[model samples]
Target: MQLTNKAGTPVQWQDYLKSGHRIFIGSNAAVPNALIDNLIENSAQLHDIETVHILTFSDNVWAKPEHKDLFKVNTLFIGGKNVREAVAEGRADYTPCFISEIPTLFKQNILPLDAALVMVSPPDEYGYCSLGVSVDVVASAVKSAKVVIAQVNPHMPCTNGHSFIHVNQIHAWLTAEQRLPEIPDQQIDPVSERIGQYAAMLVENGATIQIGIGKIPSAVLKYLMNHKDLGVHSEMISDGIIDLMKSGVINNRRKTFHKGKTVTTFCIGTQRLYDFVDKNQHVEFYPSEHVNSPVNIAKNDNMVSINSAIEVDLTGQVVSDSIGHQFYSGIGGQVDFVRGAWLSKGGKPVIVLPSTTKDGCISRIVPHITEGGGVVTSRGHVGYVVTEFGIANLIGKSIRERALELIRIAHPKFRDDLLQQVRKHYWVPTYQDNTPTSVPELGAVELKKFTLGGERFILRPLSPADERRLQEFFYSHTKETLMMRYNHHLTQMTRENSCQLVSVDQHKDLALCFTQRDHLGEIIQAVGRYYFIEASNSAEVAFVIRETQRSKGMATTLLLQMIKIAKKRKLSSLIACVRRDNAAMLKVFENAGFVRGYSEDFDEISLCLTLEETITNAKEIE
Candidate 1:
């Protein structure tokens, strides 16, 4: 074979190709279109030629049925729309492998490459040509191939980091000045935007995020505009990051690894995105082996891996690669980043998806993964699963707890069906009946966060999923505290009792809890509840605070919110029965405008508050 020092024609380079040669095409936006066209133009010159690549934005003519006899195509990840039908029809093959391990396949000769066709930027002053937008596994393929042909494109961005190769490394070269392919920005739908909002809440300031491309991920970036010192350590970066970088939100100033640099393996977006990374010192493109390695990714503290999934079961099993028996997409870097984030300090591994499919007829949160569906992320690996409804933290949860948490975030229409299925599987107790109730009033109540005595606490409507936590809260109180709240000595709280406490119908009555989150789960600090009395158009109210959390204004906050909710419900009056010796409880009710009421028992004091008259007085407590 003759190696050419100067630019050569495709026809001249085609002379060196042989039968049964495995050719690797550059992945993502850096595909060599001219060389791909050359192969299709001279298909008759080669038989049994194998082509391998990751994702390509070009027209996959080589994978079509017409070229089946001349060429065989294998894709590392099935993301391109044009190649799906061919893969499903067996005209093309899908190879499942983690993006981080693809380089090992080439270097170990497990998938030996006879030749590699790549596109690169023009050589710099030192004769080094950057791999440009896609370094990924292409760098390894070029190093392992027996012959390397390059399409030198002036349009390609000369990215930083380990994205360059010496010009002498190519066996032959040709110039192609065409613009790189672009993935048009997908329109963000309402469902995707809502999911993005919930996913963004899990990301903290000074956190490193690994987000992919799509409407949901793009929406997430939109919500992150106000976050401080965010960093990107992802397998791919798209147009979404450009705005965040410009806003100075993602300065990479606090990243534990590769501080002050945006690290990625590949890129696909509009021309503006390509131009943003061109010779940009802050953006560095590395090989997948280095960028997607779990160990390397965990080096960043507070790593939040936000990835999308096709479907998730009640058991927290995530299926992303396939739909039933059909292959939809590849495993990609989801598992790599999930585990990496899970291993990091203060990390959050989040899997986000819309509650239902695009049609809204089918629920993505199912009792079981579809038959023949592949589980890309197992139950043990799942952390936080977010949907439009809310976020479910699955880490350290039991099967029953996982089911309840997942059901809480599932589409409302499917919650009952999912509950029935979980019962059939015996994942939940037979007595468990905390399927979420849909009420218009429930939607109006937003999650509230408050700080008291220098500690942060969250106040929200008590959920049926909080049965276990409520029971734990019951045990956390001292005997004296329980007696004061219940007006009797209460020794034990059973699951049945705990379930009833959390399962109040919001339409008729109210139940709210003050909570603080720790590593184990959410801990209930205080609880306030009410039951309606239809005869007097009044409600019986109660309050309970943990022994250690009392006198910290938690009870006052819960009481104030309860009054607001009661007024919203149009209740005429509120009544409470407290032990005469419970001075603190009396003071809270008195401060909230409750007046003394007649009581038949001497050991207890009855208090009443007229909802319509106390509106002004309740504000004074705040």
Candidate 2:
């Protein structure tokens, strides 16, 4: 298959073409527009040529009815409007495959490529041209193809890693001074912002993340400005991360794999992002086979995968690539990252989407996916599911439990209907009413940050998922602290007890926890909660802190947060029963405006904070 450029006006690339040839074009923004134009211009010269690509732009020209006899299009993923229509009209075919395995399709000759037209950066001093933004499966395609053509552009960024190829490997080259295309940032809506806030709470400092490109990913990054030492191991990235990198919030300092480098297969972003990656050693672009390899991704500890979904069922099944039976997008690298991230030590695989669609007219959380919908992610693989309303932890939950958990996070307007469906489907215990009974929407609880002793601390409402953390906190407390809080000696803190401690009934109780995480992971430093006393406007409050964190004003801080929530709830007062000998606990409650009172039993003292009086006093002082 030796090839040589023919002398002509349009470069006569047709001279190198033949009937029945299988050609692959670079994906997304890296599509070789110049080479493609040449192919279309000479469409009359070839017959039955097969063209393969993923999420290509400007595909309508090639899929036109006039070229039906000459060319047929095969898309690995649909990224643009034209290709989607082409697929719907039967003008083109689509091959649904995971992005990670697409490279293998070429490597194994399952889809042997005759030629690969790609865009690349100009050859460096060593005669190596970088693949620029779209390495992905293009690297494998180039290797498997008999002829490789390149549209070398000066504006293309010369990224490192498996992104570079020797100039001699290309059969033909054409110079281009044009700027590469860009996927502009998406507008972040209110639903996306709420989902992002919850997703960000799961991302700890020093965790490696694999985020897709879209409005949700953009929104999620905005809330992470305060996070530290984050790393990227995603398939693609956009402009949202530029500020984080510049702010030193995402330094990739603690990654277990590819430490100190941001690894991605391709990038779809504006010129600013391209300029930042150009000749930047800190960012490495690898082939999809490598970047999306689950084995490779799992090597990074604390991997947090954030991906979007179209619809999820009550059973935790995720349908991301399609709406009902219609093809919307490709499987892409979502499954790759989801499985990889969950397998990583301390990893969190999250699925995020709005609870409703179409102006809140439809619920995305359904009892079952539309009749013929595909499940991109199975129930077993799903761990965390976040909607604008809340976060649902599905891992290790039973079918009955999953139904309850998902319904809890659904839009309130639809929860009642969803709950009825759940009850009909499963023989779960009956509730008094149709108001959805679920593990509280803990992720919706706002996180308050305060500085104590020059160290920042986060206080947020607790969720059922906090059972494990609460257990750790309980075990970490000394016997003396435990006795003071529990009013007796308790040696073990079981999961059931921990779950009860964190569970909030929204109407009757509100539990808040003070948490902080280091290299080991998130630890509950303290717990503060107020439970309603039946038939009374006043609530009983309790507080506990780890021995190591005591005497740091943490208790006072928790007390203040409890008071604020109680006041907002319009509760008349908050009461707490404390041991007479627990001077530290007594002082904390009193310091936060609590008025001490003697209990009927002398062994314990009652601390009460009258909200109406306190509010009046505060207003007066102000």
Candidate 3:
């Protein structure tokens, strides 16, 4: 086939077509619609033509029943209604692979390409045509294909980074002026919105994010509008990120890799989004291998990977690509980004999905994955899973603890059923019926913000699974500190003791741990707890801070928060049995407005605060 000039006609790509050839198409919206249509219209002349792509939009004609035989559609990743039906009916083949390894498959001839059909923006002054929107594996395919045919669309945006192919590299070109297809915004329902809000709370300022494409991601991005210097390193992004970039919220200033560039493999969004990436120096598009590589993604500090799941089991196993034996979507980049983000400094790998699907008809959180569902992310790789109800941190948690934490975040309507299933399937003798199994009606534990010595701390409720972390926290403290907190000369801290301390009844006890991030991971700086005294309608609280973190006002802040919760729970009073020598604890109690009470022992002093009375007095003064 002869190459065409820059100002080529629309049908010039037809010259490259032949029978018994394998063609690789661009992914998502970047699929060359005109070339695809031409291939289908001329299917009468072609036989056994293999078509390869990932997640094409509605414009694909070969996916129809009539053209299925003409083109053997082999999809790397599956989506859209047509491909779903085709795959279910055995008309099309679905290949399951991690998005990060796709480039290597093409480069190594594992998926040899006879031709590459791609959509590109009009050539710039240097005759370089950009692979707008979807760079992904197309770059590798084009590089290795026998022939490269491009639909030179004027409507396609000229993107930056490793997304460009010189006009001279094309074997044939067709000038097409149609607008790129838009992925319309999903209707953000109250449930999705709430889920987004909860997920957004985990995202910190100056964090590099990898958000998947869809309504949940878009909804989550909406809540991050006010976040500062957020960098994006996603596999696919939509319209929501454009606003954040425009408003200077996502400046990519703090990203260690691609420091000032929003990196992605592909994009799917509206026309406005196309215009935003056009000649935009801030965005860099890379092939899926480089973009989704766990090692590459981990180079950026504070990376947050927010992905979705079809369903998740009680043991933190995520089923994303399939439902039972039915294939839904490809493995894609969920594992790649999940592990990458988890490996990154201050990274959080979050799986955000609605608690229920199909208008709350079914719980996305299930007892098991229906026997045949593929575990896209294994329990070990899973860290955080978020739903509209709340966030469940599953890392370093036992099976029983993970079940309880996950059930706490399930939809309220399904919580009881999930709890019943958990008891039936995963119950142990150590499980106490009197333990408050539910996460309380007040909602998920809010991440309380507190600053000490110019450093910030996140004070959140300690879950039963926090045993390992609490053990580390305990070991980090000196014997003097431990003795003061435990009121004994305890020399050793075991996992069993830590597990007991971290475990709490939501209704009758509160265990709040103050944590901050360091180079290693999240470190517990302090722990405060209050156990209910049924006889006195009060709670006895205790505090322990790492020696280095003491006198930093964390103890005082924790006491105040305990009092607030105590009042909300309708507890009349708060008490603390402080060692006589513990001047720091005594000062914190006094500063928190606690009154010294009568003590039976000489070595300890009793402190009590009338929480209900304090709340009443404050309201009256107000």
Evaluate all candidate structures by whole-model CA lDDT and list the values in order: 0.86, 0.80, 0.81
Give the winner by lDDT: 1 or 2.
Answer: 1
Instruction: Estimate, for each residue in 354-390, the C-alpha lDDT of model 3 and write its tens digit.
Output: 8888678899988778778999999999888898767
TM-score of 2: 0.85
TM per prediction: 0.93, 0.85, 0.86
Clash pairs detected, candidate 1: none
**Evaluated with lDDT, which candidate comes out highest?**
1
Which of the two, 2 or 3, has more TM-score?
3
Q: Which residue pairs clash within candidate 2?
A: none
Give the per-residue lDDT digits (tens) of candidate 2, residues 1-622. 1123423134456656688888998887788877777667656668888889887655446666777787788989976777787777898888999999998888788998989999899888999999988889899999999889888878888888789889888878677665777778988988888888878878888889889777789889999998999999999888988999999998999999999999998888889999988888888999988989999999999999998899999999999888877888888888999989878998988999999995889999998898768898888789889987667777776786677668768887897788777778662345313343332332343555666666667776676546667887888888888789988889987766665665566556877777885422457888888888767798998988888877788777777766766777788889999999999888878877788887997979998888876632211100
- Compared with the true structure, model 3 gives a TM-score of 0.86
Worst 10 residues of 2 by lDDT: 613-622
Cα lDDT for residue 164, candidate 1: 94
Q: lDDT tens string, model 1, 1-622?
A: 2234446433464566887889999988988888777666755667878888888878877787878877888888886766888899888899999988998999999999999999999999999999999998998998899888888889999999999999889878777787998887899988888788778777778999999999999989988988899999999999999989999999999999999999999999999999999999999999999999999999999999999899999999999999999999889999999989988888888999999998899999999999999999999999999998877888888898899989988988999899999998898887787676533443422345577877877677777788889999999888898789877789999998998888777678788888886432678999998999999988999999988887788888888877877787888999999999999999999998999989999999999999988753322210
